[model samples]
Target: ACLSRLELSALKFISGLNSGLISGLNLGEEKIMSEKIRFSVVCVCLILSFAVMPSGAAYAKRELRGKIYMVGEKDEDIPSKNTTIRIEESDDSDVSTDTAAFRLFIKDHYKTDETVTLKVEKPGYQIWQPVAGKVRIPANLENYHEKVRLDKLGSHRFMSNQAFAMLIENAARESTKTVSKSDEKPDLSRYLKEWAVKYGFGIDDVKTEMDKWAADIEKRQDNLYELGLAAFYRKNFKEADEKFIDMANLPVDWAQTQYNLADTYFAMEDWAKAAECYKNVLKVYPNYKKAIERLKLIREKR
Candidate 1:
């Protein structure tokens, strides 16, 4: 069976956990991780326990020690091994080229939500990711592991998340058919050609404009929510408020977004605005425990 991107990533996640590459929390195991890496994981876990995840509820941060891979038509063989990855603004390629894995000063980046700019530059290839989220340094072990998806240079957009989903759905619906060796091969070019007729340019063009897919403010609901969450985890509470408030005013019934805005406000100790937002969350989800508890705490403060 040909797995889709999500399925492939899930397999990688499980593999990482088994191999001790899942760098989420470090119980100070010296044999498993370096001292700096251990501290970084501890910081991330502490933040999760106090602020975001609340017993690892949702948000998480982890280091990036994975390979750079190609977003080719083939789902099974994704990694573009030996393709050198250089961190942004650096002039040198990594000395180790076998794994296509670049080293980062991960101890610093993993503990905070700082944006790390990256690009994939092989002489004849480029990046094409449409539904790609911004990757913070170090893959999020709690969430799906991220692959630095690179692809061959083309006017045609290869393996867009849209077309990938279509391919996966089509494969599933045809699963009962007689098996053939020829059917096992992935044909990514067909989807690329199809989407090229519709969207004009590849998702990010050649510059690796990281927010190319996210620049459209009219389709801003999910973007703003993620931005708020990122800022909140970074402890940039003021910036988090700005993003969350913008998200809250949008025409959507997102109780969690309202609850997040309330959480941000309470973090700032703005009791009135926090109370107002918690009430907004209750209007949508009346029995949400976190919101209910926060509102009561605010009332007690008053």
Candidate 2:
């Protein structure tokens, strides 16, 4: 114990030095240190140590952060604020969403293999569901970041829990190489059949919804980029704007999409819209030179 406060105080007393510590001990060389003095010294040492050390809330064993954005109609990641972020059932272990960001402290002894669930709650926005928003803390990494996209209220995924369960079952079957448990065979169609009765949907309608979601999940951003470039080169400003806006809506490449859309608007001399798009681009990539240049041009035009 590197020169504990009690010992230090005793040394200070014997050496004819002054100290602020008050332990009720006899300071002279012939005087003995009684049990009461020792007890008082321990209490004083504890108090001093606690006073010098930072409070528990000032630090953490591990920190995790993530971004939250709403999937707007244009597919732009509009920074969200005043949203609630929770780590499982823990309300105080983490902080809420602000500036499209939320932070958490991994204070417990959670294994790397174990995953922590994150749930987001915001007015007019759908709550994040457990099946889709699993946060796996990466092993051997200090910083962990997660990106979550929120849908507007009444647009929550899955009409019912059974539909979500079916999706999970289908995914599990497709990805796993091992045979499923022989003891239990799940009937995925039962969920769809229920949906048919409740929503008056036929097989065709269900298949159509499945196909649409599949296409969206696998959409190629590069194709949209190429098409947007082609339209711009052909002087089809409207078509270029449409293509870029579509790409932006997909939430894949915000900087490129916003820049291209802004550029197309500049070509069409839509100064205000171009300025807006350029500003949007700058929000995420603040130092983007091209966007800065276009904004400068828009300012000059005004």
Candidate 3:
């Protein structure tokens, strides 16, 4: 009997035996040859499977990159001069205890042990750098808006604060000088009174200096409030109050200035003025929480 299995290769072998004569081939020999052919086919299939197996390179992760900025500020990628911002991962489920190093990771293909140096510049500001030779980004760097504060060097480099301070001081000084040179002395008593009341400057102290030259009452008010706001942000509440109160009569920036004035009143425990300021705040921002609460408390006490 002929081999039951379809051994096409074995049949080729038999046919290549000088002539196409399968009839004379022994059934036992044909069956053995067919088995070898089937085994060879299985081997070929296995080889193909191994050749196309998936690789680890297909699933590798890529690096990330982006610029960092301070809260409520903008700067270009060319290092912000006065800023030292750090990038950090958004997920804080895992924490670390590295105080000296910042936990910001900027994925610019920064390999471990790689040293990178770049300058951070800001307009009218100075550049700053990471403490060590390298900027170490925390492993978990996929999340969160990290805070970057001004270092000592950063402050010295970015002279915005100093510049602003000098501007105010100069204006005060120059106004006095101009008054001395002017043909007519300006009535600076109002300006001095407002400055004292707004910035908590004992009006009596500056009264003589202010009276020395007729001051530009309105211009002086602006300068005082601007300085006072800067001082307020710096936590000098006494100075802030003086500035806000002196410019109270000016029509511009009334709402915010009044609101800030109210805050100072609340801080000083002048409840009556505080209540009045709160009322004014409501007229501007009806839903201001602090003002609303303070106003309500003032009414309750009455």
Candidate 4:
């Protein structure tokens, strides 16, 4: 008789956890011992498989298959042409797509209880990796399936410097507001000094609200970076440049920020400055293909 999905799952789970138990069991005992005792031993083993084996263990033993989708602002599907998908530990090879969707089949690449990392990359789209780039196939089954989505990269990539500056400015403004209770107050310095003596924006209060705000921005620079990119997408180059510069000044080694700055300079027709910025990016990341191409273009223009 053909095994059902549930039976297959249960058998896979039992085999993974108690392979020794199955191997040790004696089917010959049915003839040697009483039929009742042989039946009881079989019942015990079956119970142990279900009781001790973890839920979803059967699923992990199976092959994994999935489809990729690109999503837009309204969660609408977009064409995913030229997208690349890669799986760790399976192979270093990548699969590319020419349409809005791509099918993935990973067979015999993973074992029960093992995790696999799936990475998807495409130009002009934010990369997607589930659960910090890893997913564990359940050990109980023979097959698994999933659907993945990728979001487009907008102005958020361009506006990091502007975002950080705004965050800092906002922090200072909020601090000032706390000091001056009134909405219409021009003399913020006087109020800050007075409030600092009592509530402490001063050096002594290590756990002050201002200090918390400062630390918060420092910890969440990525969020600020995204905001800056949003500004850049909005054609606010001045703000975007300011945010990118601020981010770079944070001593974060982000080649993309430098590259974006170069792109901004190029947009403004400052060929010399753009060329310098692109060269800086290549200096840090010698294999940055886009920067290499842009640098060549700038030099040709010069």
The best candidate in terms of lDDT: 2
Off by over 4 Å in 4: 1-63, 79-82, 92-109, 140-143, 154-302
Candidate-wise lDDT, in order: 0.51, 0.58, 0.45, 0.53
lDDT of 2: 0.58
Candidate 4: C-alpha lDDT: 0.53
Candidate that beats the other on lDDT, 1 or 4, i.e. the better one: 4
Clash number for every model?
Answer: 2, 0, 19, 23
lDDT of 1 by residue, 1-302 (tens): 55545445555555555456545645655445554445654555555445433454333323355566766565443767666655554332452246656543344333444545555556666545313223443235433344566655553455342333333334323432433665363333344344444334463351132133323322444345545534443335577678768766765457768888988999999999999888777544433446767887999998
**lDDT of each residue in 1-302, candidate 2, tens digit only:** 67666557754554442222334535652244444455666666677677778887666466677777777777677777767777774553444446778777765677675667666766666533333455566664355566777766444353433243334334334423343675443343544455444334574566466545434423643345444534443335477568667766765386678888998999999999999898777545533446867888899998
- TM-scores for all candidates? 0.32, 0.38, 0.20, 0.28
Q: Give candidate 3 misplaced runs (Cα > 4 Å).
A: 1-54, 58-67, 71-111, 118-133, 137-154, 157-302
lDDT at residue 38 of model 2 (Cα atoms): 57
- Score residue 18 of candidate 2 by CA lDDT: 24
Candidate 4 least-lDDT 10 residues: 155-164
The Cα RMSD in angstroms, rounded to one decimal, for candidate 1 relative to the true structure is 26.1
Prediction RMSDs, each to the true structure: 26.1, 13.8, 22.6, 21.4
